[model samples]
Target: MTAPRRPGPAPALDLAALVADPQTRIIVCCGSGGVGKTTTSAALALAAAEAGRQVVVLTIDPARRLAQSLGLVELDNEPRVVETPGSPGELSAMMLDMKRTFDDVVSAHSTPERAEVIFANPFYQALSSSFAGTQEYMAMEKLGQLRASERWDLIIVDTPPSRSALDFLDAPNRMSRFLDGTMIRLLTAPARAGGRAGVRIVGAGFAIFTRIISKILGGQLLNDISAFVSALDTMFGGFRERATATYELLRQPGTSFVVVAAPEPDALREASYFVDRLSTEGMPLAGLVINRTHPPATTALSATRAEAAAEAVAEAGGKGAKLAAGALRVHAERMTLATREQRLADRFTSAHPEVKVRTVPAAAGDVHDLEGLRTMGEALLAAEDDTGTGTPRSRVLPLRPQAG
Candidate 1:
């Protein structure tokens, strides 16, 4: 049998070329929460800009870090330029506002009077602003709009950190669920030519609930719902088609997904789940970024010292010494555990040898601006010295931007 191939040895990634590639229009940065997915998205955009490519980064990370990463106080639907020193490419960023995107869709498709009617509708408002899939669907809508605008050469997206990052992928189906569900038919029951009297009676009963909610919320809920349904009756097909197109766009080759994971087991498992789902949906899983990984050290000296400290504490036979030794032991164990996790990651890389594996060492500080992103890119594609030597040094691995 052919010797099993090793995980395509982590290759040096050319992020600029990836952004400049005529084929790649979208880059999705996804992972579980708190793994620096937002930072990675910004850094990728900044790196592309450094390489002289026009890029835009969009995110729904409500943590406000997206604003700070671009060194802005706030964000809205509009993209803002991020100027970094010594960077030749242009970069723009925006934090997605779900409500704004939703409103835009209505305004785009309907006249002001119709939009007012739709916006005032109780069910329409709830479905637009407060529903589970509304935000995700709006995000895709934003992506589609940006793609059509051709304002930026590259659109890098950071999805909401979700228990299932694939929530984004399911958004279209979820939106359709609202219209395709029994509730719509129940409301639209009057629009159908069933027994008119019974339909009116049932509709009147629904109106009672609508009026009560309107009174409680201080909005004309019934009128809004009626108007919204009336307008939506004319626009449902448009909404359905837009959502469908967005879903298709996500799965296309022009879009590439970067799955992010920290060294922790839970994060790795989440990444693995996301990878599997992306594969199932036929979305391109461009590569993986194993972040905050502990690099190996050259000093066999420190490891030896840690061992001696434990031995001395045992010999000393005192509480204070034991406590200090315990701390040392904790540090050593942490490093040992990190090494084991890195090995586990390597196994995954080996198994998916075709997938590029980039390791990003835990950076020293929080990323809050254009400069921070530049610093991040350094570690991402930093070169290694002739390490054919004996000492095992820590290496920084970044997620590959494009696999070639």
Candidate 2:
């Protein structure tokens, strides 16, 4: 019988080597919410730029903390230059605008008149702005646009958080299905047909479909949808073609996918899902980044030992007894947190031993400027060697526990 494989420590990811490669054109940072994906993306871009490669980091709904850290005062669809002191390479950053990107696609694919017609349609506006999958689809569109521009050597994409991180992979097919669905084809049948005979042939089916949809969506909404679909029918081929091209680009050799997460149970679980999903889809996996990990305050004292010391100090009841007791309690707390984080990380490493992981120790404060990000980039490499052989560094990491 085959032996059950035992888990081992994952190989360390070398961030410097990843960005130094000339052929590495795209790096995608993706994970569940609040795991520092945006900050990681910015830090990676800045580090790469500082190392002398022109880079652009595209973020989707970045948190204010992350935006401020990257010096993004007013984020929009357009990329704005970020001043990198002492760096020969340039760095630019932008946040995705789903509606504008959709409009741009429409304007590009169709004639001016047709584009206006499609844009004016209420259904088109609604879909572009608030549809469930529109943001992911537009992200793919924007990525394609950025690549086509050839303005930068490296493109770092910070994917939307939560399950939507996977949506980009499925968005093209979802869009294709929507366009080729029964309702859309039924609505566009007359448009596809030529002259009066074609209209007569399609009129009955179109009327039935419209009536059925009109009951669920109001009459005006159904009419708006039918009109929009008809107007967009000619451009559907182009949308699908571009989406497919973007999907292929993601799977290309020069592209790499980094799964970011904290050393917590739920976040690590999400990371595992990302790893499996990327592998199943045959995407190029560039290893994992375990951010804001905690190492014990002092290796000389264990959590139990700290607790015992605290108890002894409290019982002794001297002038400084309370202060000493409080300090011991704090040390115990730090040891407990570190042990919890280590166990969680080990669980993940055990499950996916082949996947490389780079751990960054928790920072003392929130990263809010260029210097902070540079420090963080350095931490990605430095923390690996600081295994607490001597003095302790920080108490606990600032990472929030992600919900599964």
Candidate 3:
């Protein structure tokens, strides 16, 4: 009987090449919370800048990790240039201020008087700041604005840390639907009719309906919403149009989505969802990045053998033997952890064999500066074998002990 062939490692995701390509205008890093999406986006942007591409990274994460990593005091709605000494290209970074972005959209599309009316509305104030999906929608709006400017060769997007990774992809459509939905059209019908006709449009039946809605929503709140809708009546079509355009932009050839996840079951499952969604939406997917993986320093010694050696050394009971045994125990523990991580990664690979993947070993400390980011960037771009054994350069065995 013929033996079953063992599956080879997943195809390597050449992130370096992906960023270096002039045609790659946008790279969006998205995944579940605490998966290093912010760090990955910053590192890739720094790497691309050093490689001579004019790069801008926009982070929607509220944690401000990206600012710290980029060595910036603070980041706001506007793009701020990051000083990269001895680099061939320039880099800029920004954090999405959703409220400001929403205001900008209104001001840009509306007459000054009308914009003032919309901005001063209580409902608009609430909507711009804390409405459901506003942050995600504005992130898309900011991305669309950045792309339309044609100022940078590459735009790296760090998606928001939402409950669901799909929120980012769903934002534009959600916003478009909100603007064009039946209820919104009904609310603004009076405003569209104008003056006396506006009053006539809200006749006995409509007045009764409004009264019922007022009882449910509170009369003041409903009035505020009607006023807000009235002020925004002319700009609704513009909102829907821009949202549709941005959604289409995500599906274009120049854009690529990199799903980032840690080497754990839940994170990898989220990555799988994102990968499948990207395929369904026809978005260009660059690959998967498995971050903070615990690959063993040396795979030559199996965990079982390491444990046995440690036990034997401890039983011998020499002066330095205790220390040596401790070291061996530590190595054994590391090997065990690495094995678990690898198994989890393998399960993901088995499910998604065609997706290219790159694994980054866990850093000894958090990356909080440009130098640390560069180190992470190096690790991200490091080549790995077909067996996914991690970076070959760092996989050396321990040196032999000297005999006294």
TM-score of 3: 0.91
List, residue by residue over 48-102, the lDDT tens digit for candidate 1: 8877778999997777888897888887889998767777888899988888889
The residue-by-residue lDDT of candidate 3 on 1-404, one tens digit each, is 66644344677788888888999999999999888889999999999999999999998888889989999999999999999999999999999999999999999998999999999899999999998888877887899999999899899998876545457668767877887787687787765666886678666546877889899999999989989888888887787777779889889988999999987889999899988888998899988998897767667788899999999999999799999998888889988887777677767878888888888878899999999999999887765542344343222222223433
Which clashing pairs does model 1 show? 120-224, 121-224, 121-225, 358-398, 359-397, 359-398, 360-397
The ten-residue window of minimal lDDT in model 2 covers 391-400
Error of 1 at 277 (Å): 0.7
The TM-scores of all predictions, comma-separated, are: 0.79, 0.89, 0.91
Best by TM-score: 3
Q: After superposing candidate 2, which stretches have Cα over 4 Å from the reference?
A: 1-6, 195-197, 297-300, 308-329, 383-404
TM-score: the better of candidates 2 and 3: 3
The TM-score between candidate 1 and the true structure equals: 0.79
**lDDT values, one for every candidate:** 0.74, 0.83, 0.84
Candidate 3 lDDT at 121 equals: 90
* lDDT per residue as tens, model 2, 1-404: 66655344567677788887989999999999878888888889999998899999998754555569887787789999999888999999988999999999998889999999999999999999998889988999999999999999999999878867878898789988988888787877887888898888788777777788888998999889888988888888888888989999999999999999988888889999999999998999999888887666556788899999999999999899999999999988887888787667767878887888787777888888999899888766454446445522211322333433
